[model samples]
Every structure is written in C-alpha cells, then in structure tokens.
Target: MTSPITTLTLDGLETVYDRLAQAIDRAGEDKRALFLVKLALLNAQALGDAELFQQQMEKALLNL
Candidate 1:
C-alpha cells in the first residue's frame, strides 16, 4: 500500500518576509538576523517541512 502525500502553502509569506527583512536590515544586528532565521526554521518544523526549514534558513541569511 502507498501512503498519501500532503502539501503546504504559505500564502503571502513572501511579502511579509520581505517587509520583516527590511526591518531587520534597519535594525542592523547580525545576532537578530540569526535568531529571526531560527524562528522561521522552528515555524517550518511545526509545519513538518524540514526541507523548507533549511531553505528558509538560508533565504533568511541572504541579506545578512
């Protein structure tokens, strides 16, 4: 037997992320950037997508 597959969609997350990134940039703290990325990854884990967690972590670090 085969199991079912589940998909995840985060509508409007990009826009929110962009705005938050802008704020982080303004704050100008490397540690803050790291923690924000950690927070995002933790949320991703709650959503059950480890791959997305990693991707978001990297993406969060991009501007830093």
Candidate 2:
C-alpha cells in the first residue's frame, strides 16, 4: 500500500542508517548517543509534533 517513492525512500534511509550506525560504533558510544538524539530531534521536527514524537522517542529509548 505504499508508493514507489516512499518505498525507495524507506530503503535508502535504512541503508544510510546502517552506515551511520557503523560509523557511530567506530566513533564510540558518546557519538552514538548524540546520533540517537539527533534522530529524535529530526523526527520531531519533521513530523511537526514535538510532544508526541518525543513520547514515542522516549518509548523507543526505553525499549532499546
């Protein structure tokens, strides 16, 4: 039920995230934590719902 562009974007993001994760690992845990916070802030900004996105981000962090 997804558009081609959406699917492509998701796949591309996944690949980029994989690489980011690898680089963060090499850089150390501090960088990794910063990367996660950056992702959360980006998500909230992009979604236009800072409160809701933040709650979800907290849940994800807890689960992680």
Candidate 3:
C-alpha cells in the first residue's frame, strides 16, 4: 500500500525550516554533508517505507 501524503502547515513548515537551517549551521562546513546524510537515513528509518523514501528523494532532486 502507498503511504498517505502528509502536508505541513505554514507555521510548522517555517519551524522545521528554521530548525534545519540551525542544524546545518551547527554541523559546520566540513560535516554538513555527513550530518544531512545521517539525518535523512534516520528519517527514512522512522518512516519505514523504502519506496516512499525513494520517491521523496526523487522529488527533492527536482530543479537542483
């Protein structure tokens, strides 16, 4: 079965965006990539759906 799409409200999105930016800054220039990979892996594990994660990865790659 496909996972349901979840949408964050504007406030929630802003909160998340702010926190993520803070986290990346805290990770510093050298460790930022590693930190992001670790974060993505942890989130994917929590999500428990490989196909959904793959789809999300594809979406994230768009226009970049």
Candidate 4:
C-alpha cells in the first residue's frame, strides 16, 4: 500500500517572509532592535542557529 502525499505551499511562506522582511526594513533604528531580535529568532529556527538567535535576543534586550 502507498501512503498519501502531503503538499506544502511556497507562496504562503514567501508572503509571510516578505512581510517580515518589509517590517524589519520599515522599523526605525531605535525600534529595530526588538524587530531584529524577533527576526533573528525566526531565522534561527528556520536555519538551525540557536546561538545566533540567542545572541540577537541578548543584544536587543541590552539595547532596550
């Protein structure tokens, strides 16, 4: 017997990523620290870089 195949949506993922990137770009430098931290966390999860994500979070917190 063959198992069912699941499909993923690239368009939706692209849309979300684009929005996040745009948000990061639009944020002011002072406000960007937090935004960057959040982006870094997401990037870490997506790219498997926990250390970098944690570093970004710490930097953001320090800036705050």
Q: Best-fitting candidate, measured by lDDT? A: 3
List runs of model 4 lying over 4 Å from the truth. 1-8, 36-64
Q: Give the TM-score of candidate 1.
A: 0.36
TM-score for each of the candidates: 0.36, 0.46, 0.89, 0.38
Residue-level lDDT tens digits of model 1 in 1-64? 2234455356576777788788777667867867676766676657676675677669867979
Clashing pairs in 4: none
Q: All models: lDDT?
A: 0.68, 0.69, 0.94, 0.71
Could you tell which candidate, 1 or 3, scores higher by TM-score?
3
Better of 3 and 4 by TM-score: 3
lDDT of 2 by residue, 1-64 (tens): 3222223488898998898778778868767788767766775666676566667767877946
- Residues 22-64, candidate 3: write the lDDT tens digits: 9999999999999999999999987889988999999999999
Query: Which residue segments of model 1 deviate by more than 4 Å?
Result: 1-15, 22-27, 52-64
Backbone clashes, each candidate: 0, 0, 0, 0
Clashing pairs in 2: none
Error of 1 at 19 (Å): 3.5
RMSD of each: 6.1, 5.6, 2.0, 10.1
